[model samples]
Target: METILNVEGMTCGHCKAAVESAAKEVSGVTDAAVNLELGNVIVTHDDALNIGEVKQSIEDQGYDVK
Candidate 1:
């Protein structure tokens, strides 16, 4: 499954990397890509992945997931 999360406060390369890293660390996530320009994170994962977990992971990185 794929999940797209609308995020806020990502303004540069560091933000992009941080969000991607956080998302990828979640169990069952296969890949995570962030589009700073679009303020979104596209996450690819299996059914076992919890959407709330990914959101909280990004939130822990200091970004707000909408």
Candidate 2:
């Protein structure tokens, strides 16, 4: 399964890396990709993953998830 989240306050490479790293830390997440230009984070994971948890992970990194 794949989930796309809109993340705010990501302005550069560091922001992208932080969001990606946080997303990947979520259990069951296989991969995470952040598009800085679009402020979107795409997460690839299994069905067992909860979308809310994924959002929280990103939020924990100080990024707003929408």
Candidate 3:
């Protein structure tokens, strides 16, 4: 499964790395890609992935997921 999350406060490579790392750390997540210019995250995961958890994980990294 793939999900696109609109995220805010990403301004550089570090922000992209942090969001990707955080999303990948979530259980069931296969991969994560961030587009800093678009302020969005594209996540690939199994169907079992809890999207809410993914959002929270990103939030925990000091980002805002919408």
Expressed as tens digits, the lDDT of each residue in 1-66 for candidate 1 is 898999999999999999999999999999999998899999999998889999999999899999
- C-alpha lDDT values of all predictions: 0.94, 0.92, 0.95
Candidate 3 residue pairs in backbone clash: none
What lDDT tens digits, residue by residue, belong to model 3 across residues 6-46? 99999999999999999999999999999988889999999
- Could you tell me the lDDT of residue 43 within candidate 2? 96
RMSD of each: 0.6, 0.6, 0.5
Whole-model lDDT, model 3: 0.95
Off by over 4 Å in 1: none
TM-score of each: 0.96, 0.96, 0.97
Model 2: runs farther than 4 Å from truth?
Answer: none
Task: Give the alpha carbon lDDT tens digit for every residue of 9-48 in model 2.
Answer: 9999999999999998889999999999898999999998
Residue 18 shift from truth in candidate 2, angstroms: 0.4
Task: Give the local distance difference test score of model 2.
Answer: 0.92
